[model samples]
Target: MDDLAVAIGLVLVIEGLLWALAPRMGRRLLEAASETPESSLRLAGTLAVAAGVLIVWIARG
Candidate 1:
């Protein structure tokens, strides 16, 4: 859908800005994330999904 494509594009733009402006910090964050436990990452990802859904639902309403 068009909305999904725009959302993906926005994510890419935000991520690109981080790497472009602070490559070192981005690399360090990646390293930290790699060292983080799988369970923590999974929980964080789940929370992010829930939050995103809630935001969209509220915005649409």
Candidate 2:
């Protein structure tokens, strides 16, 4: 639970920094994402999750 909280917090900080530093880019990205197909988005999300799990597993070991 604590690890999950920390991971969520880190994600928020990274996302916040991107928007803070590059607001226009962030907006453009969001717009692009909105127009992106759902299947593509889901595939990207699935890959991200798998990569994250792999990272955590390696880090823990």
| Model 2 ranges off by over 4 Å | none
RMSD to the hidden true structure, all candidates? 0.7, 0.9
TM-score of each: 0.93, 0.92
Cα error, residue 61 of model 1, in Å, equals: 1.2
Cα lDDT tens digits, model 1, 1-61, are: 9999999999999999999999999999999999999999999999999999999999988
Residue 10 error, candidate 1, Å: 0.6
Q: Any runs in candidate 1 off by more than 4 Å, and if so which?
A: none
- Report clashes for each candidate as comma-separated counts: 0, 0
Lowest lDDT sum, 10 consecutive residues, model 2, at 52-61
Residue pairs with backbone atoms closer than 3 Å in model 2 (clashes): none
Residue pairs in collision within model 1: none
Give the backbone clash total of model 1.
0
